[model samples]
Target chain A: MGRWQPGARERLEQAALDLFLDQGFTETTVPQITARAGLTTRTFFRHFADKREVLFAGEESVPERVARLMAEAPPSLGPMELIAEGLAPAAAEIFEGRSLDYLLRRRAAIDAEPALRERELRKFSLMSEALEQGFRDRGVDDLTARLAAEIAVTTFRIAVARWLDQHGDPDLPATINQTLAAMRHLTSHGGCSPFLTTHDEDHHRRDTGQLHDG
Target chain B: MGRWQPGARERLEQAALDLFLDQGFTETTVPQITARAGLTTRTFFRHFADKREVLFAGEESVPERVARLMAEAPPSLGPMELIAEGLAPAAAEIFEGRSLDYLLRRRAAIDAEPALRERELRKFSLMSEALEQGFRDRGVDDLTARLAAEIAVTTFRIAVARWLDQHGDPDLPATINQTLAAMRHLTSHGGCSPFLTTHDEDHHRRDTGQLHDG
Candidate 1:
């Protein structure tokens, strides 16, 4: 009825990720992960359904979680406004408590495997669909809802990517905000030179309450 | 290397599509497809590498084709400008001569199968990568190149979906243009009500040469 080991799941995950990094994903086995985790194979099976299954579902129900967060948002906010003010924060918060290094390792694992990559893409696709439905339920028009949802997911993707690149700031929320600004700027101005504008300037402006909350 | 039957490829494709629709993708085989088209299995093998292969590559090398077209585009165009003016037109032209009905059938077969859907997504993913590289080759910065490329794919996806919905007009290039206008307006204006404004209005405006070729 409960996790008897308390942290057995996390330990197994960490050990598997390390093994995936060191010995390769296909080369790693369940018993190997269990031994590395100092847990039994039974415990590993209890934590994960199978080997590839462990490659994902670290944040299982992610799409539903995002949709649930957006559901609590104000109904009056427009598509872009909801995305920037609502979904961005929610998305950033979802990954806030997790270890950035662990995330980077997880990303490497997914990236190295085509099957895992497809599964990741499918999860994001589902998230987009959920967000689209949330916007529609919030009274946004059809096309705008679809556009907003797609852009929301895209913004999350780009923001997380930039954050994980490791050369930039480690603040995930700021990176998310910065990514939203970049999207709005690119779409609005149709220019590329000003893309070099630092997120700090936009961050300061947003701090002064300059959001277009239509 | 020249085909003895000039129409053999098209016949195999169409017959395979029809069979996939009638008897389902798994149920239909190469022999059945050839039989339906009054051709030999040799001809089928000559065309498609396998059964699932027919489910995709109706326009094989699409990403390369797009990147090649964009390679010839002027370097002065901004990211969004290149996408809207250069890439959109090029994408539309690539699908211009094909029959919409055949394309619709192909879409159905792909959508009906998860493997096919993932393959389709992978193709589009490759297309986005190709487009991103094209923008970078033109000297656009990294982030903007990614945004432009991703948005280009998204716009193409939405426009084609609307076009295939078959409720409205069938001129795909115009639909592509309309999608661009919508993206710009959404990003620039941040409002949802005006999304109801028909593409015809923007069509007339573009017809009058109001393009922002930044």
Candidate 2:
């Protein structure tokens, strides 16, 4: 019951994760988590609303951090670069120092649990919303802001996938930067297709004639 | 019993949506839906496993249709163009001709219900997976495929939002095309930031020197 002490939440989280891995998410109980953490059920409840909450305790802070970072970024950086800078701290602080085995196991646990996956998706949605708002605040237009934010989220998700799959090689930030660069290349070169350039020409030619009927 | 005949599923869906809107999702019962639809509970069960399934009845077809469209796209079209073509049908089929009032109310109901929202997100994730697989089947690399599919989803979502918000202005296909074009501009100009061009120059300079450690 005295688990209000510093680091008690961390202990509870680690214990809950271990139990969820050893047994299963549904099979793991609050009492089991408390006992493993050397705490009590009361302490467990105080730290987390439920066992699942343990895995996502600090997630709410992510949007705020990303938004703040984006807001603080220098104006000279491009929208994509600003987003990259915004996410740099999260990549370093949350994903760094975690062993590959731990990350993969944690990912497995999350994948195996539907509720956790839903929660993760919700988190991603929230992050995207925050990023979109950040871009809008910087005077970007509505559609442009939304696209940039969504693309940034996609970049982050792909980078995380590569990082998790490849044992966190080159670190999260580097992977994200590389992924963004690839997207830039893909979009800029029109996927390097002459057919695309021809279509673009036709689209532009018709743009003044029929497309702006809006 | 006669509910097993034509359009029974659609009747059940319309009834469920009405009941959900009037009495709330949690308050609405299967019996209530059947009563409203002038059918039996057995018929309801035959059409849907439960009430929530009504809103998502035909959604399972979305991924298959999108994937099939992507697979059939001409190789001359680039990745983004292929995706845009894939989604052109959905914009016309699902969103066109729907009254703004009806669309807004439907969106409100889904937004108000947590379970429905979660189900929607899960459906989006599944669609992304199918699209990614479609790209992979066409010989795109893993990360590139994922990025293209995710970005396509982003384009679809943003276009839908605009359509829903502005009473389907510019129509669905046009909105999607415009959104994609904006993304193309954003990526090509690199947000028109001088800092980015310099970085790109440096990146090119170092491309053969130190970046290939990848």
Candidate 3:
């Protein structure tokens, strides 16, 4: 048997997710997670400070990468575009081809448990702050940077939902681009209706008043 | 002594905020809070399920009002506009004349404490879901409704931050409306540039040239 042994961390996370899904997050305990993973309690502790950390594996790198991208991006880009560019590759790497079932399950678990939900929000808030700092580093004003960071996050979320619904077939980068385009359309044309002048409105009303009234 | 007694819940909240601000949220406990409030443990528990609940007393009514406005709004308004209109009055009613010191302190507490931050995110998620449902109830499709809800939340966050910074002096409704207008402008202009062709060409050159050089 020349194969590399499974790391304690990996084993612990897998066991935790399984237990969390099967027995529910509230019912699952650290000792049970460690035992199922064939690791000692000390090993579990060494890997994760607490049980909740198991559900949040790999999230730490997301903000770092996003910050790096924003720092290295072209200076000429507008605030929103710069933030979007910074997030695109990171989103592509972390989100593309990811298991929707796993994500949906994790979301459900968080929704069902108050503690887990709080942890998830803390992660999001950290991400938002990181993005805002990135924009500020590029000389954007505080309020504008904060607003742009928020819009970027909003686009990321909308893209993720769209991607998840499509069974994660679309590349994350493309999905983000498409969502931005849709946002443009939404904000610009106000959803497929031409701007109506007051004259046109009155004439139309006069022309169709009986039809509408009846 | 014909002095009126302060409400138990309000007393508890004031005491909790003071203690949490002074000693930090983690270091504070129920008994200490109740003692500070000059109330019994039973009186404290009657109002709040836990110490943390005391910090977030008005969160429930904000969402309820937002949802009600969304539900009762006229059907002809665009989804985003409808959400904006729904949130504006609520913001005016709830946020005007609010003390920035308490808000800033509360935000700091939440940021410093992981549990509180997560609870805040859960609240945000609930608001987003409520907004989505509101749009759906008005006959909007699922995807569009979700997108609109996200954008609305983003606008709300920006408006809130701006309001907080202005010493809580700006009319919340006007600030919200202005933020929505800014978002619309940013999204509609397609990267916020007048010289689109040149901008795209330069962007393409940078992107492709980077790829080729790498």
Writing each residue's lDDT as its tens digit, candidate 1 over A103-198 gives: 888899988888778877887788888888888888777777778888888888888899899644767778888777778778766656563356
lDDT of 2 by residue, B1-214 (tens): 4534677887887788888888899999999999998888888888788888888777788888777777778866767667657677865665544566767777778988989988888888988898889888887877778888787777777778787887878777888888777887666554544233666646633531324544
Cα RMSD for candidates in order: 8.0, 5.3, 7.3
Query: Model 2: runs farther than 4 Å from truth?
Result: A1-3, A75-78, A94-100, A192-214, B93-101, B192-214
Residue B77 of model 1, lDDT score: 71
Candidate 1 residue lDDT tens string, B91-128: 66667556878888888988887877777778778888
What tens digits encode model 3's per-residue C-alpha lDDT throughout B1-214? 1234467767787788888878989899999998998888877776778988887777777667777888778778887657656777766666554466877766767778766866777777888888888877887767677778778887887888787778666667778887886776456433344333665645534632433444
Candidate that would win on TM-score:
2
TM-score (all chains, Cα) for each model: 0.83, 0.86, 0.81
In Å, residue B68's CA in model 1 sits off its true spot by 1.6
Candidate 1 lDDT score at position A27: 93
Candidate 2 local Cα displacement, residue A132, angstroms: 1.4
Candidate 2 per-residue lDDT over residues A127-199, each given as its tens digit: 8899899898887777778888888788887888898888878877788888877787666554443233556
